[model samples]
Target: MGTMTPAQRRALYESARFARETTYNGPLGPEYTPAGTRLRLWAPTAEQAAVNLYRKGHDSPCIGTLPLQRGPQGVWSIWLPGDQHGHYYTFTVTVDGVARETGDPYARAGGLNGLRSMIVDLARTAPAGWERDVRPVIPPARRSVWEVSVRDFSQDAASGVRPAWRGKFLAFTQTGTTLHGDGIHPTCLNYLKRLGVGYVQLMPIFDFGSVDEAKPLLRQYNWGYDPTNYNFPEGSYSTDPARGEVRVRECKEMIAALHAAGIGVIMDVVYNHMYRYENVLNNTVPDYFFRQNEDGSLSNGSGCGNEFASERPMARKYMIDSLLYWAQEYHIDGFRFDLMGLYDVDTMNAARAALDALPGGRDILMYGEPWQGGGSQLHRYEANKANLAMLNERIGIFCDDTRDAIKGGCFNAREPGYVEGKPGSFWDVGGAVAAWCRSDRLPPHAPSQIVSYVSAHDNFTLWDKLLCVRYERPEFTASDPVALAQNRLAAGICLTSFGLPFLQAGEEFARTKKGVGNSYHSSPALNRLDWARAGQYHALVDYYRGLLALRAAFPRLGTTDRHAPEALQFFSLEQPLVGWALPAAPGDGAWWRALCVFYNPTDTSRVVPLPAGQWKLLSNGTSSSLWRGESRTYERKALLMPYSATVFGAV
Candidate 1:
């Protein structure tokens, strides 16, 4: 599309007053060229705007200041005649006769601690072989996501990462790294490969405000929820943040390394709110980017002080453009939008449509948290999950029902779920498991629309939750064999469920956050993944590995059709012992034609009668022994151990 004239642009913006389209807002950032750099700022409420060019390593006393000419629809533009690639610049906009200096909201790079926006030649920032980088195509039904934080992945002493590379993006690129195993435990990329997760949903990597990029080793750590620059990579994760290109290159290299290891990368994006109210967008156009209440106060739907008005035309455009930019520029395989429900459904649909239009875009995964932190001005039906019927089939929402059902309530730590042996909890938990596992209950258009998991980055880890429950109830003990069995059962249900399976980092090995529920600002000692824990719970890790392998081997477990009739049949809904049967389809491998899975949370062994066939015991709590001779007659009962799960199959 050609550039629109000033008058045409104004007319376009005016015509689409509240419409959710980005075409009207032309590019609103520094556009670089060999001869010069063209700068544009969208400050509709501003009466004047100017671009101040600064020398390297200097914040004040700019080398030169250029006045920006006013364009239609409150746009200001200025062009330098010579190349300005290495210089830093900031815009000074006079809104309501008050001048305020701010960085470019669309800047691809930022100076120390994001104090200023830097003009960069994006072509030179790409790592070697970046042009050939391609993400692996993973179907939604078969997707296994492993969520991770860049720093926490390798920051612990037992992480086995190199000294210089520890806690940096380069840490993921290390080859043949192993942690806490006697020549058996895989570390880093090899660990991921062995874990069998198809995608790595990385925590926020954008230029966030919490970490001081200028001094990355100053003992400051954040989960990166507070975004400063949407398009730029966070400098704290790079070995050198002084040069903007280094952060960009290191991030791409990390993505390339992950792709090389047969794992796709999913970026966790936070577009609902920024780090501060004094952000660049707010400074340039006061109160324009955020949602306002009837009293002229900013909305706190994000629970982070202010929320972005994504329903607005320009805001919607910015989000869509940022998503496409990352998909193309960084070769991102997918996106995990943080607090996505705060955004309007139309904007999300537009983003999916735009992404689908790109090459190999159909394979890109799109999913997010379906609920927001607080009430939004948009109707409840406009939320992502509430409006799933209107959303495209490719988009998925996290299944909190399954999560809470297996592990207990997220808000209250004392309340126990079915796995915890809570009285009268089996019926609800069984229904939730069937709904998510069979793809028939709580139905979406497709099975890919639901993402099932027991735990994630938000609340307590599975192990920690069990420990907390033990503290609350005298009957439950942390190290009890029954608790361990319950933990295994939770993992079994999550991995064996029908929809996409998601696991938080270190979940396989029983990761813990020391009983701290919200670790967003916790120390590295609390947030870092302790590989030693993996060693302690090696059996549990192996069980998780086996479950993933079994799910991969049996396509019947991961059906993509949501409308397909109940693939699972529960024997009795009222009993504490839950049993289901899954019949395999025709033309299958040596795998059985019919599979029976049973869960017994009671303390005593339960003898449950099977269907009319000789059933082979594939997995029984501890190990997966696929021996054909290890069979039990249908008429003769099968034994289920207390607080354990068993899988039986017959061809």
Candidate 2:
């Protein structure tokens, strides 16, 4: 090995200029065709490249080896004639005379733990009636998203999922599942419909490195944030990890079932950084995939060791291509990017445009965390909170401003937001309602770009966070009047406010993780959605349902542009007391001509003024109903409940 000349360095200028000069997006992984599978890889620096045929997915020796011919654009290709669908393969590339073996970065499916890439027809892996599967259409303003984990979704015995399918992708296919006590109440799929959420943002289902897909899963738990195989469904979520088809087919079955239930599935994808820096993408193109510091070390932007040099042409191509593959192959309704801020603005826009080009792509929701994990040199091309205006519309960014303003700062678990009774800044609350939450919170951009949520998989559940500051007990229960009231208040504020309403799985019933802030590796005891609590706190569940129904009735509540005077008008009131009104459809027969909401986070109740006409009270924080049976009418003023939200519809 010797130092490169300036001419050679100019030819391969920092890998970026060199990559920009070359174009090859035709195909990189194994091409499963009628004539067999043609394996191809891009390794410009490779001295030699070969395909090692393995007998099994794990702990298997190579049965045969086939040398790949160096082709144009540095792509090594080997054409295998005859059936090679079931065969497992790995690329052995010698970079700088040092041999490194790895799986396909573009593999649609993979063997156990993603140690080897599996060759198969992706279409054949789809469940029956997959082609006919129709993704439920949901307007950006009306999508109520619930973040859920595949394992925790049904791992509980109380979930009524059969033992065989308890934690697998097949659990979603189980309909009419019931809890332990009643043996009749809806639990899994039926429970989702009962909850009335349009989309369930599944925690990373792509093959990740944290959990062993081969071993019994009862001993292991993770949120699946560490991705090993970007395209394939997580093997642990499938009935069988050895057979790659099972994971693929079962994942399709889950998506199809969700569609049948009128619920769309949003995949949580970690594209910023993978579990390992020396992964397939790195093994094949060592210095091409990741960003590097001046010392030639990988950048730690993702806080997960290495970040994709996303600005590079080929790297960006792989990301966008993978996103399209999931949309086209698995029929994934939407995508929620993990650590999306690491993605360059151009790359995010490119992905948005590509997804939009699909048949029903407009209905598909696209959103992500617009804040990077740690350090980055990509501030020039950052797709972050400060630069929301620079990105394309329809690509939503998480509203942490509204999140902290309404509930409290996410980083400081013990801090109090408005609902937690800290008398928080109403400006941020107004901004949240505005979908911009406020200018200090963010620029008053398009409503579609704001994803307003209080709790997700990243931190503590809303219940746990509320408990951390209020209670001493570590029990994951939905008890205590003020705590329950506060929980309901948080939901009420987010639902009634602008942007896409999102909550964690079982947050309606105060799903707690025993006060554990980061339960990414916690036991199943803490993660599973306690169905018994749904029965215990049925009233709270009803309140959340009512709010969702009201939101559905007023779709623009989630989609209305911030500061849109025609849609929302603020009622002049005392400081820290936020009140707004939305004019309903013009008609006398309508249940109400206008919808008004007032939020009070104080210990003492206050008389909030109402409009001239007679108004029917819809919710008192605890009960969020649009109907007027339990509550009475008010003309001038209504007593705002203590630490609660009050809703009134003008008659």
Candidate 3:
């Protein structure tokens, strides 16, 4: 996904090596501290900038009174050590002799208002980047990962509480959700603990303008996409927004809470660009950061107004440093890079290396959207050991295949004979499932990785997709308002599929965003999960819970190894129902069981061939029931009632 033209590829070695090497010269300085605080802010256009520390009890201290030193290039730095906790600090700079502006240069945490900078208790902070205690431990022989977002987790904040005996570092995982006061709600942590997801992937929490900042039509607040600051979590979501110190402290507290809940934290970072285009950083450091066109225009590589010149060593260093700071300071479990392709391949690898050198390298999860501007294909991303393709062995990606399969468009499943279903219909659902089912079949050059999900923050909810698919083809729509049984079937497909399954905050009860596929501009109603849906569709909710339990119980079902699609044999008759059979391994008599999965997209009885024998029903869509194994001849096939999916095994 690294940016490049075909010409650049031909002479890639030269052009790629030094395409954009400018350093990021914005907000560069040491951490403010108590010997007094020598403060520095990036003010290229300032005649002079001074640090003014305002303490609660002491007299107002100005830069001149301290050891403040104004360096060349307008970087004003000085050692002011008398500062301490409860001290409020800001930089006042005089520009053009008359213009004066005051702001926080290095806010550990706060919103875009940037009225003040918070003091830090570095002693309590987590290591910034990798966890050096562990080396590169090869991934488990099998991995069963479930993705959960924090915001949409149950309202009970304590739901993520883990056993007291298990410490945070030992049991960290990832979950995601809408930003709430003081990070993801406790309910998210509790739900993740109960659900046993390995990680929590949080959406953007940086300072962004209100929807009102843009046009009215785009005025909505379901997502956290509008970003103003790259370094801090938005103060609005913190417990105490009025006090920057409190907000910063609360953020660390939130991370600690999640760790205690036994869930790793993966921040959804928007490093591709920033908000307030005319902010001091971009305007003051001009050519030192952003990419420029040959004609002197801005390069819109990130689909944003401008893309950071990550190719630049300083830009890369800044990003890497920030990442390390978060990993070490906050004990963040992983990072989900936003618009990852905007960064250079080498730079990405370097960041990964830096993380690997950190304290918890073995547990760090690094993954992202391997695309840029919608034009780049996921496969087109850099293939280096650090890229998503290679990282899949270590990290992973938001697998589009799972989305496409349930929609029916995975691999050869689209072509004739490749898949059996209502002919000529877009197998979009099937395609989405294919990512999970057919992933092992991907080219060897591709990483053996998959991030399976029916829906995510960027697209329509799975329910919305089902409705659209039904609308596009009336045959798929339901005659009764029962929310379409096919929708339930699709859910089963995802929970049962291979690889990591990412559940959006609200997909459990078929939450809908009113078909506004990209609900980034929608309000809380569209994004906030209506927990009531659990009562509305108790059947489906229980279904997913059972599925998770089943995955946890059966190691063979969730193997992360490379397995060819042929390992699974698909069978169907008259094509209304499709069945997959996973044969057991040799020598393992208990493992020799065959799971015949049947999916009926129709509203009638489906008689599926089951190698006639008294077979036990491992699980039925309706409830929890275990049927004893019975002997039978391969004569009569099992019968599946309309609009359902059943998994059976030889008794």
Candidate 4:
């Protein structure tokens, strides 16, 4: 291999961003080439560092070894001759006179079980037409993100995905896959298209430490919150964990397939913490990547062993560079931070600005959990819903107020919410419909900042939460109609509210975890998407789908302007009946001047007085088909059915 001049080395460093790195910010991991592979590592505190290459992914014996020279800014470097692609390598860093072997934290690909880093040929990982793969552009008002996990999408036999492809990256690429091979019932990518959601928020797909990739024979399942390597795709999700390039190729194929189906992808990232405190980051540079208390102990803000020290310049630079890599390489539509509140306001805004500078990233949808699991070491982290204003408008936050207000408290199972006939949650519900603008409660600057959702991966499913109501009321048992009505009511409140609507996978059909509150490590039977349930609860699925279509048709229903909530006027009616009207601009070939909606949670019927005009009924609680249903017009008062929500559009 020809010797790389100093200019070529600097060029390689510039690709990872920062040609002239300072401190710990510099080119990292192994970058492959046709002539040779350039390897670099940032072991600031280590006494010495070297690279060892193995023949196979799981091989223990080293095929060759090379000593790396220490350079400026604590960066270790080495230029290997010949094509070193596909070779499994690890860094041996000597710290305090003790030599330790560890994988690269910035590795874009990993070998089996993610124990070793693999040098990958980036061009070979691309699928056919990957260079020309297209992503759909969806406005925030029209965006509906459906949260899904890779394993849950097709692990069940009834999902109709081919045997080998099931629970793998290729599952998403299998078009025409159906339930029971009936062809009528769409599954996976087809089901996503039929649901009409703009984006799919894939739960943690990064290489994690929980599931053993080498032992796929066992029934090892997890939500994959334990991130071992932040850059590479989870090896277990790939067809073959032994070949690092296979995962890189197949993951892109999954993304390309979804993009072809007109669905954007949102990656669920867990950058707040690592799976273990003594990881690659700490192994190379001890006590630098994680936050430490005054006592010199690691902080547990993430409730995971340690929280990332994102406030540090080098740590923050790593995050931004990783994000840009995903955006440029995989064409990721958006990112959902697992515990966004843990990151300081400055880091988030800077990341947002960096993404915006790239094409199609200006209106990128970025949102996350507005709070953390535990307390942080930093005094003012902007890690909570109360600090929403400190973030950019494009940086969205999950509206826990609306989530708890729609259902009961996420933590408390028995606590009833507005739909469950709770007394005072009505005001919060009102605030949610306007995206909580100009309210005493937490109000993000714009409706775009609020992500309205009733149920997600963390809490109980909407259907089961309604089922929980049965334990308290007794009268509303499993057989009663109250549970179903409350389920629909919860959906209606969330879908019709202002802000982007997000739902969990199979939420339209009321996916349940067998009442398991936290199914992080539950059996596959409890977590897999039950196609039988989807068929059984077809009515609820249809109901949810119709609401999505209604929202899409009427863009005014999703106005992000703060004053849009101010224009909302509530009815004088008290408890049991919550009625409000918002101004709607003329569209859809129908001059809809105003839209009025009524929610009757009580067992008795309620009447809502409407303006003097012909009102076209869109949703009669059950069906909201734009053109098919009985379009009823009301002149005066509309009688809402017991335990149902009614909608009317003024002409």
Top model by TM-score, which number?
Answer: 2
User: What CA RMSD would candidate 1 show?
Assistant: 4.5
- lDDT for position 133 in model 2: 92
Residue-by-residue lDDT tens digits, candidate 1, 1-651: 343343443344345552333235578788999899898887776777898888752445788878999877677889887978878988898865678988998888877777788898888887888888888866543578999999888887666788778788998998877774346666777678777788999999998998877665537778999988898898889887877768888999999999988889999999999999999888986666677765556779899998887877778888898999899989999999888889888888889999999999988889899888897765434546657777787788898888888889888887788788887766665665554534344545566677889889998888778777767543321355666787888887777666778999988887878677889888878888888777677888888877777776666655656653266777863377788887775554527777788887777888888887777787786774443245543544788877777887775
lDDT tens readout by residue for model 4, 1-651: 243343443233224444235446457777789899999888765678988889787866898778899988778899987987888888999876767899987888888978889888899899999989866777654699899889988898998899888888899999987887888788888788887888999999989999988887238889999989989999889889889999999999999999999899999999999998768887886666677776557788899978887776678887888888888899999999988878888899999999999987886678888888788875565645888888888888998889998888978778889898898888888888888886767745888778999888987877778777667543321444677778888888888888989998887887777577889888877888988777777788888888887777667766666666777788878685888887775453323667788888887777778867888887877775642455768888888877777777776
Which regions of candidate 2 fall more than 4 Å away from where they truly are? 1-17, 437-440, 472-478, 560-567, 585-592, 626-633
- How many angstroms is residue 448 displaced in model 2 relative to the true structure, after the best TM-score fit? 2.4
Evaluate all candidate structures by whole-model CA lDDT and list the values in order: 0.78, 0.82, 0.52, 0.81
Single out the weakest 10-residue window by summed lDDT for candidate 4: 10-19
TM-score of 1: 0.91
Can you write out model 3's per-residue Cα lDDT over 80-119, one digit (the tens) per residue?
Answer: 5664545555555654354343444345644224444545
Looking at model 2, the pairs that clash are 431-437, 431-438, 432-437
TM-score of 3: 0.73
For all candidates, the clash counts are: 0, 3, 84, 0
TM-score on alpha carbons, each prediction: 0.91, 0.95, 0.73, 0.94
Model 2 residue 597 lDDT score: 91
| lDDT digits (tens) for residues 108-175 of candidate 2 | 78888988998888778868888799888776545889998999899898888889898789999998
